[model samples]
Target: MSARVAVLGLGAMGLPMATALARIFDVVAFDIAAERVALAVEAGATGVGTVVEACLGTDVVVVGVRDGAQLDALVLGDGGVADSLPTGAVVVVTSTVGEAAVRAVAEALAARGIRCVDAPVSGGPVRAGTGDLLIMVGADDEALAAARPVLDALSSSLTVVGGIGAGQQLKTVNQLLCGIHTAAASEALALAHRLGLDLDACIEVLSQGAAASFMFADRGPRIAAQLRGETPPLRSRLDVIGKDMGIVGDLARQLKVATPVAAAAEQLYRTVAAAGLDASDDSVVATMLAKEPAW
Candidate 1:
């Protein structure tokens, strides 16, 4: 029989991920939002009202929380799912919470004879629904084996980074580049708009040339659309990227690394958040930057 899976926290990423896993496994989904749970059921997965209910008989639990605090609250201490999960069941963390946080959770889960797979994923909602994400994993052989089927169903590229916490470490590195690229893309596109050039043509050219980056390719059109005063759907929110940038900063400080560029990007995200755009799509940064005197 296929490994029974439970997906927790069905937000933007979690919902699509649940849908993808449902295609291959007996997926049970849970979220705080009733609407989200209903949507998961519509996507061919059983919907549970609570984390405990979702993980009761599941072999693997996939968590997609917003940050370390949520992840901790959901799986550790009193009334957490760790107490409810079966011994030897694996918990795959797909959030980009920090290394230390994941390590703490892993250690806690290990004490219960449960396994934790630190697998932070990249790629947006569309890629997630298609099972084409890039997953960075940090776990021992046994734990990895326990979660391999779920991870494989969710990822097109899965790289084993190291022991527990390494996935979060590498994901921090990945977010550093992503955060910086997003800031740079906004700045460059804002400049292009100011230069009286064809923004679409410029984006097309830059995306094909030395200036090319995945952020530019993925978020570029959205940036251009924002320039046209159109509201792009909130695929990735400003606060989400801002939160990742904050994680990058925290990790850099712990390592005592000087990341002036990433720091700058982090500040840019802060500015956008301060402008009350935290709930908006991150592409709105391009719009905010293209304004007069560019904050």
Candidate 2:
């Protein structure tokens, strides 16, 4: 039998994921933004006004909001999903929230006899639409088994990381690497421009060599466009990476581990965000580098 799934938060990633889930399950999608809810509905999802209403009678509830606080509001606040979920239903928290927050939510849901899975995902909206996201799931054996099919419907790669909070722990590491790599790519491109090299050829050659990275290949064109004053499509925002890296910083502090590269990358992103370019694509950081005063 198909699972009855309720997807909350119909944002860039969530909307596409919910739409995919609707194809195989009875999906009721909800969002704080009515426009997003409307979009999901138009994409064949059933739109609901509230999170609680969406979770009602569902076999699994997917919470894809922005952060820990938003996840708490959806699951533990007044008329939250926990309050509305039928007993034995599973609650999947797919936000890129940190480990501690996932632990707290998992414990709270467990008290109410609702299984909770911290299944944070990688890959952006485009991958989510194609059901090719990388899902790092954190749950016990039974919960993992119960949630596997739902996750399989949305992800091309699903890894069952140990227990509660493991998925988020892994995602934190992923964000750290992402921040560092993006910063490195930005710096390399800026240096290439400053050296009076042909920017396109420089990128093409570097991308074919040992210096190449996913961030370089994916964001290189966008970085070049920012240098040329053309805004690229919004894929990943500077503020979003800043937020993720900030979470990584917090995790590092809690674990007493020093992440110097991630710290430097975080500062660059914070600078971009503070300069009122938070909503711009992360490649815009190259613009900041290009405008720096000569020292």
List of clashing residue pairs for candidate 1: none
TM-score, one value per model: 0.96, 0.93
Model 2: lDDT equals 0.87
Q: In TM-score terms, which candidate is top?
A: 1
lDDT of each: 0.92, 0.87
Q: How big is the positional error of residue 164 in model 1, measured in Å on the Cα after superposition?
A: 0.4
TM-score of 1: 0.96
Model 1 accuracy (lDDT, Cα) = 0.92
Question: For residue 283, what is the lDDT in candidate 2?
Answer: 95
Q: Write the per-residue lDDT of candidate 2 for residues 47-146, one digit (tens) a residue.
A: 9898778987898888888788888888899999879998888988888988888899889888999999999998888889878999998899877777
